[model samples]
Target: MDAQTGSTASAFPPGFPWGGAIAANHAEGAYLTDGKRLDISDGFPRGIKHEYDAVIDPKKCYPTHEAIDFYHRYPEDLALMREMNFRAFRTSINWSRIFPNGDDDEPNEVGLQFYDSLFDEMRSRGMEPVVTLSHYETPIHLVG
Candidate 1:
């Protein structure tokens, strides 16, 4: 069976929403900077030898210190997406970027600035930006 030979039927109306997906810990790299506190995802051990067991050890973990380095390279990244004629981009914002330390008197300005620029770039490129508040990596302080 081939997808090209499959029957075609209108499952829904046209103009449906379609986009890519990304996660905080898997994308954002500002793990413990700019007032951002460590989250449980940071504590999850990486490179597990067994594929069917659960392991949680902060000491043995390797946090995504520069996962894609999107924080500093978002402009270029957005440009690449624009080249692809993306109608929308789906990404998650780091909770720590907004509420560093989990609870604070106010949100961090530097963190906010990055997002502001990102959104502006997306709009300027004629692409809509879809944001997820917390796909993962909730500040450990929020656990209790």
Candidate 2:
């Protein structure tokens, strides 16, 4: 047995992928704005809903839709993250933002452009981006 039984040494190698996590509905807003359609996340109840129950009307009561407003405020947020020396950012895509109706022949150009700009900003700041295809905000249309 070693003299020092407990140590704070790390087992992982250096530069082992450090980043932050962000959810779609929690970060990006504009849920029903622009060309985006409503998603299941948008329909979630304002305060709390019973288990196995759907949020009938989202527009009226929901905690998100403007949670952090990252959609319209990503530039500032990215800059802040850069200042914090973030090496990477892990965020999910808003299915509704990309495919408003969840089943479309083409993706929304504006939505694509927004993400492009976001990635560019991250790269410009010497940071890597890890994208998650879907977190929790699946388009409501897909439920059917």
Candidate with top TM-score is 2
RMSD of each candidate?
A: 5.0, 3.2
lDDT of 1 by residue, 1-144 (tens): 347868565453565544556676787776776766776566554675433212334456454555777777878887888787776887877877778777878998888887888889888987788988887767677873
TM-scores for the candidates: 0.76, 0.83
Q: Show where candidate 2 strays beyond 4 Å.
A: 1-12, 51-59
After aligning candidate 1 to the native by TM-score, how far in Å is the CA of 32 from where it should be? 2.1
Q: Model 2 reaches what TM-score against the true structure?
A: 0.83
What is the C-alpha lDDT profile of model 2 across 64-136, one tens digit per residue?
6778889889889988888888889988888888899899999999888888988898889878989999988
